[model samples]
Target chain A: MYVAVKGGERAIDNAHAFLAEERRGDPAVPDLSVAQIREQMALAVNRVMTEGSLYDPDLAALAIKQARGDLIEAIFLIRAYRTTLPRLGYSTPVDTGKMATTRRISATYKDLPGGQILGPTFDYTHRLIDFALAAEGDAPPAPQASPLGDVPRVTGFLDREGLIEEEPASDATPGDLTREPMELPADRALRLQALTRGDEGFILSLAYSSQRGFGRTHPFVGELRIGEVAVEMDISELGVAIEIGEITVTECETVNQFTGSKTQPPQFTRGYGLVFGQTERKAISMSLVDRALRWKELGEDDTGAPVQDQEFVLMHADNIQATGFLEHIKLPHYVDFQSELELVRRLRAGMTEAAE
Target chain B: MGLLARAPADRLAALYPHISEHAVLRGPETGAVMVRGRQGGTGAPFNLGEMTLTRCSVRLPCGKDGHAYVQGRNKDHARRAAVLDALLQTEAIGEVTARVLAPLAEAESAQRTARASKAAATKVEFFTMVRGED
Candidate 1:
C-alpha cells in the first residue's frame, strides 16, 4: 500500500513568501520602480516587449517588475495578460518604405541614396566595459543632422533594374497564427509572422547554421533600417484613416545569390525581416532563417537541415512553450517514478534468482 | 468605437447613476488578449503582442442586453459601458444618447483635434533646391 504525500499548504505559502522576499533582495535598498526599469533597463524591456509581442513599454516594465527582472518570465506574463483582452481593431500595415529612418546602412552599396546615417549603433564600440558608467553621470548630447526626405529602399533600386525576384503585391488576408491552428506548409506571410515572434537565440543559431554550410545561401546585408512608423486605422464611421499611434520597428532585407533554375532566370533572391523595436540581431537572424526557409519555394534543393523544416522550426520557436514544457519536470511525477522503481526491482529479483 | 470604449468611467457613472440597478449578465472581469498585425496594410496576420482588456455584459431593467469590451484593465469602465449599451437599446435611447454619448463624442473629438494639432506643430517639410550645377 502506498500513502500519498500531503499537508504542505503552509510550507508552500511560506515558500512563496520567501520567494517574494528574495525577489526584493535587501529591505534597506530602495525598491526599483517600473519607470526605472523602463528607462534604465530599456534593452531588457525591449527584448521582453519584442518577444512578448506587445509594444507597450510601460506594461513591459511592469511585467519585468512583477517577474523580478527575468526577461522570459516578463514575456510570459505579457503573453498571459495578452490572451484575455479583446482585439479592438486591426491597424493598416506599416509601410517600411516610408519609414523615417534613424539608422539606415547597406553593406552592398557605399554611396547609397540615403547616405549612411550611423544613428546610435554598437558596431564600432569596443567590447571593453567603461567603469565610469557604474556611477550616474550625464552623457554628452549626440550630434544631430537632418535626414533625407523619404530615403528609398536599396532593394527598390535592385527591383527597378529587374535584378531581383519580384514579390507580386497580394491583397489576400493572411491567417492569424494565434487565433487559428498552425497548418503545415504555411505560406510566406505565415512563416514571416512566426519568424518575427520567434525566440531570438533559437533563430540566431539556425541562421548561423545556414551560414556555416548547413544551407549555404550567400546572404548580403542589402539594407537594415530602424525607425518609427505611424499606425493607422480606417474608421468606417468617420470615412477616413486616423493615426492611432506610432511604433519603432527594425526592418532588414537580405539579398541572396540564386543560380538560374528551369522555371526562372538567375537573379538575386530577397529575405525579409520586420520586428518590433530596435532589435537588429534578431532582425538579421530572422532574415537569414527566412531565406533558408524559402529554399523550397525558391526551387533550391532541400539539404534536410533543421531550419528548412517549417513545422519543426515554427512549432518549437516559441520560448514560452519551450520553457513551460521544460519546467514542468518540477511537478510531481511520483506515480510514474513508482512504476519505474517497481519494474527495476522485479528485474533485479529475477536476475538474482536465475544466478542462484 | 475606441473613443466611446475609452470614455472615462467616472464621467459615465455621473451621467447615469441609475446604472447600478442594471444586472450583470456576464463578467466585468479583466483578461489578456492577443493583438494581431498585418503586413503592408492587408497581408498576412502576425501576433503583435498581448494587451490587457476588461469586458462585461449587462441586462437592463427593460430586458435589453448590452455588451462592452474595452482596452486596458478598468472593470468599472467596462461595466458602465455595458449598462449604457443596454440602455441604448430601450426607449430611453434619446435621453441616454443626449446625456452620455453626445458629450463623450464631443470630448473625444476635442481631444483628438488637440492631439493632431500638437503633432502637426512638430511636422517638418523638406525641399531640395535646384543647384546651378545641376
Candidate 2:
C-alpha cells in the first residue's frame, strides 16, 4: 500500500536552505566582505567583468561571493543583471592613441617613441608561492606617479611608413551580443566582441592550440598596452559629446609576416585584441585567434583548421555557451529518454520478427 | 496579442506592430507563437510550439533584405523583434552573430555547466549487500 512519493516542493526548499548554509560556511571565522573580495581578489573580479561584459567591480564581487567564488557563475549573475537594465545610447569608441599607458611593450621594435615599461607582470616572477601571503603580512604600498600625457599608439608609427597593414574602417555600427544570437562568418569587430566576452581559460587554451600546430600563425606581440581610457558619449538632446567615465582596458596587436596572396602584396598582417579590464593574457590570446580567423578574408586557402573555420570558430568561441549546451544533456531528460526508449524498443522488435 | 481578423496579409500587417511583420505563419495553435527563419531556434528542420515569437522583414539602407525573430509573450517581445529586425537588415550577419548570439550562448552555457556541476556534486552511489543466510 506504498504510494508514490510527491514531496518535490519540500525537497527543493530544503536543498535551497542547505545551499545557503554551505555558501555562508562557519560562523566563527571572519566572513569575507564584498569589498575585501573586490580588492584582494581583483583578478577574479576582472575575469567576471571581462566575460560578463559589465564594468562594475562591486557587483562582480557580490556575484563572486554569491556563487561561492565560481567565476563563471559570477559572470552569469552579472550578465543576468545586465540584461534587465534599459538600453542606454552607445558610446563613441575610445581613442587608444590618447591612452595614458602604464605598460607598453613591442616585440617587433625595441626602440619606440614611448619606451617599453615592464609594469606589473608575472613574466619576470619566479613561479613560487610566497610564504608571506599565508601569514597575511601587511605589504608596503608602492609610490604612485602621475601618468605621462598622451602616449601615441605603436600602430600609428607603423601606419606612417605603410610597412604594417591597414584595417579598413567601416561606418557601420557593431552588433550587441547580449541581445542577439550569433550567426556565421563574423567580421573583425564582431570577432573581437566575441573574444572580449569570451572565457579567458577557453581563449587561452585555443591560443595555445594555435601555437601547438592546430592553426599555427606565427605571431610576434607587436604591442601590448594597458591603461585607463576615457569613455565619451554623444548626447543627441544636447547635441554635444560628453565624457562619461574612464575604464581600464588592455589592447594588444600581433604582427605576422604575410606571404602575399593573389589579391595583396607582402606586408605584416595584424591581429587585434581589446578587453575591458587589465587582462593581458586574454588580449594576447585574442590577437592570435583573431589572426587565425582572418585567413579566409586574406584569401588564404582553407586548411581545414579550427581557427580558419568561421562557423566552428564563432560557435565554440564562448566558453559559457559551449559549456552550457554541452552540460544541458545532464538535465532530467526522462521525457525525451522515454520517447527514445520507445522508438528503440519498436525498432528492435521489428528487426527480430523480420529475422525470425 | 490578437490573431488576424481579416485577410492573412492584413492580419500580418496588424500583427506587424504587435507580433512581427517579418514572421510567416507556420501554422496555428493555442498558445503557439510559431514562425520560421534562420535566425533563432534550433537552426534545423524542426518544429516548435508555445513560443512567444515575433518576426519581421525589413528593407535595409543598402537595399538588402533582412529578417528577425524575437521570443517573448507580449508586445515588448515584438518591439525587441522589430529592433533586431532593423539591425539585422543593416548589420552584417557575422557581426550580429558575434555581438549578440555569442554572449547569449555564453550565458546559456554557464547556466548549463552550473546545473551539471551541481548535479554531479550530488551524485550518490547505490549498493546492495547479501545476508549471511544466503
lDDT, candidate 2, A85-131, per-residue tens: 44444555666666656667788776666666665567778989988
Model 2 TM-score, all chains together: 0.68
Q: Please, what are the lDDT tens digits per residue for candidate 1 over residues B1-134?
A: 35446666677677766664778988887765444444422235555554455668888777888777665567888888877777777887898889889988898667544533333333333357788994
lDDT of 1 by residue, A1-356 (tens): 34478889999999999989998999999999998998888778878878887767778899999899888999999888677555656655677777767778888987778566666678878988989999988987444333256678888788899898776655466666777888989887788878887899999999998888888856999998887666555645446665544567888889999997887788998888878788999989988988888888788888998888888899999899999999988778888889999999999999999999
| TM-score of each predicted structure versus truth | 0.76, 0.68
| Model 1 ranges off by over 4 Å | A1-6, A236-239, B1-134
lDDT of 2 at A1: 21
Q: Which portions of model 2 miss their true places by more than 4 Å?
A: A1-7, A143-147, A168-170, A342-356, B1-134
Among all candidates shown, the one with the greatest TM-score? 1
Best by DockQ: 1
Evaluate model 2: give its lDDT: 0.61
lDDT of 2 at A226: 77
User: What does candidate 2's lDDT look like per residue over B1-134, in tens digits?
Assistant: 11111112322343333432433322121121211111100011111001122333344445544333322223344333334445554545466556554554565456434433332332223357878894
